[model samples]
Target: MSDLNITHEFGYKNNPNSQAFIESFHSSVQREFVEYISFNDIDDVYNYYMSYIYFYNHLRPHGSLKYLTPDFVFYLFNDNFNDFISSYDFSDFFVSVKK
Candidate 1:
């Protein structure tokens, strides 16, 4: 096995902006799927996660995306995603950062 060294950082100490989003996603995964589901094996785990991730990105309404699914927002603002993101209000999601 390969040794991988990683640092532990609590909350958003490193990057307040993006860290909040990352934390929220992790929390959602725990709450939405991990807490209640059990997998028979590795393949089952992989398959379930693949479906869940697709649903989360394409069908779920994210408040940060203005209550739009990421897929819709992505296509709607595909030309300049950064520009579209800059105009929207992220406060809806940003304010609810966990820890």
Candidate 2:
């Protein structure tokens, strides 16, 4: 890190709350996605995770966002939020993909 001119920051020692969000995401990924997949190689892992990330952010409805997708929430808060909400029907927008 010193040679690369990068500063490594550490969370407060013994403070679990500081790492709660990262822990939660890791747990979710392990339980929901990683547990089910058998990867052949690093490329396979990378490809699978790339698709999963797209599904996670664009398709999956998160409980924390009141069942709205992260992408939807992002658009909802954008400058044209009202225009988007008025023109788009999210109820029938979802397409089911078999894993």
Candidate 3:
């Protein structure tokens, strides 16, 4: 849904974990974005958020997947991780230390 006011606007039905996760995510996002930014206007905040979102999606490593980024695993490995599974091809391409 487009509405970010998830908890207040649309209450979590049976999943309380989702609410916690969203709260945690909001805290993290604030720490990473809102806390540092000096908001002059909503447009400026939106622009900054767009850039941050790009970084989160494309650059940040996911902890669940052995700390490898989604793009790094899919696109960086040419979408075929098995191709480099034989050798240290894709594994050694980036940081050897998982994340």
Report each candidate's C-alpha RMSD, comma-separated, in the order given. 10.4, 5.9, 7.9
Q: List the residue pairs that clash in candidate 2.
A: none
Compose the digit string of candidate 2's lDDT tens values, residues 1-99. 899999876778888678877777788799878998999999999999999888788778878888888778998889988887788667645667699
Clash list (residue pairs), candidate 1: none
Candidate 1: lDDT of 72? 61
Could you tell me how far off, in angstroms, the CA of residue 78 lies in candidate 2 after the best superposition?
1.2
Q: After superposition, how far is residue 57 of candidate 3 from its true place, in Å?
A: 0.7
For candidate 1, write residues 47-75 as lDDT tens digits. 99998898788667888878877866775
| lDDT per model vs. reference | 0.75, 0.82, 0.67
Model 3 error, position 26 (Å): 2.3
Per-residue error for 94 in candidate 1, Å, reads: 24
RMSD of candidate 1 to true structure, Å:
10.4
Per-residue alpha-carbon lDDT of model 3 for 78-98, expressed as tens digits? 756555456433442364456
Deviation of model 2 at 27, angstroms:
1.1
* TM-score per candidate: 0.61, 0.69, 0.51
Q: Ten residues in a row with the worst lDDT in model 3? A: 87-96
Q: Quantify how close model 3 is to the true structure by its C-alpha RMSD in Å.
A: 7.9
Best-matching candidate per TM-score: 2
